[model samples]
Target: MRNLKRLSIGPIDLDVAGGEIIALTGPSGAGKSLLLRAIADLDPNEGQLSLSGEDRNAISAPAWRKQVMYVPAHTGWWADTVEPHFADLSRAHVKNTLQRLGLESTALNWQVANLSTGERQRLALARAMAHEPKILLLDEPTSGLDSENAARAEKLISEIAKSGTGIVFVTHDVAQAERLGTRRLYFYNGGLHEAAP
Candidate 1:
């Protein structure tokens, strides 16, 4: 990013390489989500965001968004059944993904109405990965899960990051950030600064 500034959050000039996770931590209402939204191009902002030499401005928003996927804290389910949501991607593609996130393979056969909040969260993560985005803008991806499921999510996400996809995640838990982020940044007062390991 070259002078990436979002709703008074930053002129954050960031360079994230593939296989790296950059964690953003901050107090509540400190524009952490705003920054992620700006990076995802979901909101209006100023910046030069590029990926693998492709300029964000040069590409269409929909196309750019396809490559840089954003998964929000509150996920939306539009289908009546779980399998329909993943029909194009196929259940087999995400079979291991569902299990990796502590969901059963039979979860593919479950109905959308039957899924709990935690199941929705895990399913959203799987959906995002199915697209195989070049970058992931994850906002509290495991906020709805229990401790056991959260650990599974963290581990699965770490493995996905290792596959050369850049990830920027926001979390209120400092410990969670430390565990997931290869580098960490503090967000406050509309500024971003490096955090100590």
Candidate 2:
């Protein structure tokens, strides 16, 4: 894929591609999330971002969102139970995703208020993946989980990437990036620099 011309986000410049897992890593306040937001068109900035050769400005916001799903670091659950949130999805698929993420089926019925941080993170991921968007933008997806659960989440992400979904994962964890990313984009000094393979 060809890298687009550098796009400006605040004071940063970034050029990236879709269809591959591009990990954004750097110290805090390096604008990793800002870069993702710019691509999502959630922020007003002077830059050009295109997906599958379609210019970002040419598409409706809702249309862009349908193809590009962004999962934030902290997810909010507005419903009392998870089942209702996933009601539109197939029960079997929901159950399988929960199981694969190391969550119990019973958690689907549990009150959202009662879930732990890790549980909520997994649920958010499941919710995002239920729609099977072509591109996924994730921010610190495994930060809330323990080592084992984190590994499970990573494996699930890997599997999703292998299935041909483009992923842009933002994380500070070097090992997670190394494992999940086909390419690495280091965000520093308000710009993205490609990392050595």
Candidate 3:
């Protein structure tokens, strides 16, 4: 993104190379989520964004969003059952993702209302990964998980990036940022600044 500005953030310029993870950290209301939303085109903002050198404005919003998937912290679900929220679970990759997240395949058959907060977060991530996006904008992806599940999530994220997905994730855990970020960015005073690795 070049000169990306949202609400009170930016004129920001950033480039996330393939297989890279950029970790965002800051105080609450620092516009961290706003930056991700802008990049995903979920919120109105001024910017020039491109994917693999293709102009963002050149493609339709839905198409741009498909390639650059955004999975919010609390992902919205419109269905009563978990299966409806995702693509065909028969796919090997989808099943693999669920297993990797420590979720049983049967979880897909359960009611959405019955899930725990951490389960919801993991399922949301699994659903997002099913699309096989080139870039992922994640907002506090593991905030709801316990230590074990959080470690599983971090490993999965690292594996995904290794497979060439550019990722931008928001997190409060400084250690997690260091563990996953190829580069770390700190949001402060209405601007994003680089942080030491």
Candidate 4:
């Protein structure tokens, strides 16, 4: 992204290579989520955005979003059952993803309203990985989980990055950022800067 502008953020530039994970941290309302939303083209913004050399405008919005997915902090479920949210639960990779995230296969049959916040978060992450996006924008992905579950989610995210999927995740946990980020970025005074070593 070059000269990316959204709300009070940016006129910014950034590059996330495949297999790289960039962790973003800052105070609340610092526009970290906005930046991700803009990158995903979920909101109106001005910039020159592209992926693998193709301009974002070159493709339809839906196509662009599929390749650059934004998984918000709170996932929205349109269906009553969790099974309806996934395109195909039978795919081996999809099942594997769920298992790796410490989710049971039976959870898919449960009612969405009955699942806890942490369960929904893991399920949402699984849903995004199923699509196999080139880049993933995660907003506080492990916020609702305990230490054990958070570690599982972290492991899965690292594995995804190793497989050549670039990731930009926002987190309040400093230790989590240090563990997962190839580079740490700080959002301050409406600008993005390299975090102190």
- Which candidate leads in TM-score? 4
Candidate 3, clashing residue pairs? none
Per residue, candidate 4 scores C-alpha lDDT tens digits across 1-197 of: 99999999988999989999999999999899999999999999999999999999898999999889999999999999988888554567777889999998787798999989999999999999888899999999999999999999999999999999999999998998999999899997778999743
Regions of candidate 1 where Cα sits further than 4 Å from its true position: none
Candidate 1 vs candidate 4, TM-score winner: 4
Error of 1 at 35 (Å): 1.0
lDDT for residue 34 in candidate 3, whole number 0-100: 92
Tens-place lDDT digits, model 3, residues 1-197:
89999999998999988899999999999899999999999999998999999999899999999889999999888899988877544567777899999998888898988889999999999988888789999999999999999999999999999999999999999999998899999998778889732
Clashing residue pairs for model 4: none
Pick by TM-score: 1 or 2, better one: 1
Tens digits of per-residue lDDT, candidate 2, 70-149, equal 88899877788878889888888888989999988887899898889999999999888877777888999999999999
Kindly provide the TM-score of model 1 when superposed on the true structure, using C-alpha atoms. Answer: 0.93
C-alpha lDDT of candidate 4 relative to the true structure? 0.92
lDDT against the true structure, each candidate: 0.86, 0.79, 0.91, 0.92
Q: How good is model 4 by TM-score?
A: 0.97
**Largest lDDT belongs to which candidate?**
4
Per-residue lDDT value at 67 in model 3: 87
Clashing pairs in 2: 12-190
**Order of candidate numbers by lDDT, starting with the best:** 4, 3, 1, 2
